[model samples]
Target: MAEVKLFGAWGSPYCCRIEVALKLKGVEYEFIDEDVHNKKSPSLLKYNPVHKKVPVLVHNGKPICESLVILEYIDETWEEGPSLLPKDPYERAMVRFWTKFLDEKCMPAMRKACLSRGEEQERAKEESTELLKFLEGTVSGKKFFGGDNIGMVDIVANFISYWFIIGQELVGLQVLTKEKFPKLGEWMDEYLNTIIIKENLPPKDKLTAMFQARFEAAATATATAAAAGGGGGGGGAPK
Candidate 1:
């Protein structure tokens, strides 16, 4: 077996994707947790100079960056457990298509709702809800994206298992509803219910606290900016 090592931030679902893949494959490796926000380590920079982000997988002394790419690498490298991807070329293509859609299309709206406020947040909430319905279409008639078992799509969509809660809470809006998206909502339950997935997930309370911190900081910055703008606009007038 090739020596494997993972460098990642515990709270990041992207990191968790690769982690779950390795576990499901029954691969053994070392794990290193980076101080995601406050400290930037030299090793993180050296391994992923371009992105300098978490979830970099090092296989046999070579580093693989990007969550999806690393997922494919691990799947292809190990031949145990269920395949991360489908063997059928058409199904594989479909899996890849939806995964890309989640990253490129769904993620942006989700991020906008999570990080932005006011009109932008509301707009993102609307976009996110529609995008989620589209995602539900992808689920179709399967227990998971890989049909009976969890696969690449399940790993890639791992964010929805947990982070979706934080996003909705942050924006104070409802996008994913059981009535509107029964399939996808059930998929979320199935994904989380999977044993390895449930065990490996970051603590929900910590994740929520982290997001709440972001919201509070953004609010403070907006308030400070408004105060500065008001003071600057009014100070030139003589009493």
Candidate 2:
């Protein structure tokens, strides 16, 4: 058996993506939760020298950085069950296109919603709505992004399903609603109902409490820093 290890964080949706992909593939690997904010471990630095990001997968002592890259590597390595990428070249390219789009467009809106304030927060909300609209339009009739079974693009896009709900509460905004985005709302239900996804999700109550506390703490810190005349500005909100 190859020695597989994963460096991740508990509350990060990015980390959850890798965990879900690994579970869906039924791959056995040791999970090492890293303190991404506080202090990263020596091994995490050694493995991911470039980005120093979490969700780094080490297979047979070789490191794969970035969640999407790691997911692709995992799918290619373990070719037993469901395949992540489509067999058809055109379809595969389409999936890659959407995955990259989600990372670039959708993800930035989420980040802005998480950390921004005042006018920045309003701008983030507008951008987030546009992205959600695009997603709803795209997934109108598709069973999954891959057409049937879940695929790499679906895995990457799945973050919006669960994490968006938490963001709704944390950011004090409602981006997704059954009335507004009915098709996407139904798609979220289908995605969550999948046994593999449902089984691997973090506890809801626990996650809610975690996010709520984090938001409150950040708010308090921001207020305190402002009162102290300290400089801590810029960057979009959390997702």
- Please tell me which predicted candidate would have the highest TM-score against the true structure: 1
What overall lDDT, based on C-alpha atoms, would model 2 receive against the true structure?
0.81
Clashing pairs in 1: none
Tell me the TM-score of each prediction against the true structure. Answer: 0.91, 0.90
lDDT of each prediction vs. the true structure?
0.81, 0.81
Residue range 152-234, candidate 1, lDDT tens digits: 99899988767876657655767776778899888988989999999999887888777777766666665666788832111
The sequence of per-residue lDDT tens digits that candidate 2 reaches over residues 200-219 is: 77788887887776666666
Lowest summed lDDT window (length 10), candidate 2: 230-239
Off by over 4 Å in 2: 221-239
